[model samples]
Target: MSNDDGSMKELVEFVAKALVDEVDRIEISEITGNQTNIIELKVAKEDIGKVIGRQGRTADAIRTILNCAAAKLNRRYILQIIDE
Candidate 1:
């Protein structure tokens, strides 16, 4: 989401593309609020596993990265992984 300086959608796209084999099918959306920025990630059905990883560790890692970056900018962000 837009965090005053710039949009965090780029980060979402990068993460989604990295996680999916079918990069062309990946989609990322941003939702921002006073509290936090939400990044929704959608990928090809077959590649969902790659994004989520075993026990959702990979997904958590993505969120962690988002949070870390946001913290550096003195902003807040969240990554919401979805399938569509």
Candidate 2:
């Protein structure tokens, strides 16, 4: 029932790859809840720029997609981008 797992993975990869030259070692975690879904992302320092984009436009877009997707499922989602 968690198709978003794949969606989460895709989104993570997209952001990570866009922000960094390397594609490996990108980690994304999803917390499912009746009230809201939380997505945590961990990326390498070198690739942080790609994840955040110029003025965080890329990050904003990713969050928007997550919010939209979760809303379709009658839920709320939050994307938490962490540096680790």
Candidate 3:
């Protein structure tokens, strides 16, 4: 992973940890591609709702932040919240 990828992973992890009750259960994985990067986030079953928020607004906000950061690097980022 490139430094940008690592920073993106850290950004997701940091946000997820702040939103969830089970911080230790949070797991973040990144799949880097030529033009796009996928960041997969896993949290405890009970904390899924917190990360996603009502009507997915919180999740959307996170993605917006990620996209803004990715824009500076000329990349696209997708954040996938995995409940399992």
Q: What is the lDDT of residue 44 in candidate 2?
A: 78
Give candidate 2's TM-score: 0.77
All models, RMSD in angstroms = 2.0, 2.1, 0.8
Select the stronger candidate by lDDT from 1 and 2.
1
lDDT, candidate 2, residue 28? 81
Residue-level lDDT of model 1, residues 19-46, one tens digit each, is 6889998888777678776778888889
lDDT for model 1, please: 0.78
Task: Give a tens-digit lDDT track for model 2, residues 1-84.
Answer: 467555765765575666666567678887777786677888877777777889999889888877676666676778888776
Ranking of all candidate structures by their lDDT, best first:
3, 1, 2
TM-score of model 3 relative to the true fold?
A: 0.96
Q: How far is candidate 1 from the true structure (C-alpha RMSD, Å)?
A: 2.0
Model 3 Cα lDDT, one tens digit per residue, 1-84: 678768988998989988998999999998888888899999999999999999999999999999998888889999999987
What would the TM-scores of all predictions be? 0.85, 0.77, 0.96
Q: List the residue pairs that clash in candidate 1.
A: none
Off-target runs (Cα >4 Å) in candidate 2 are 4-6
Higher TM-score: candidate 1 or 2?
A: 1
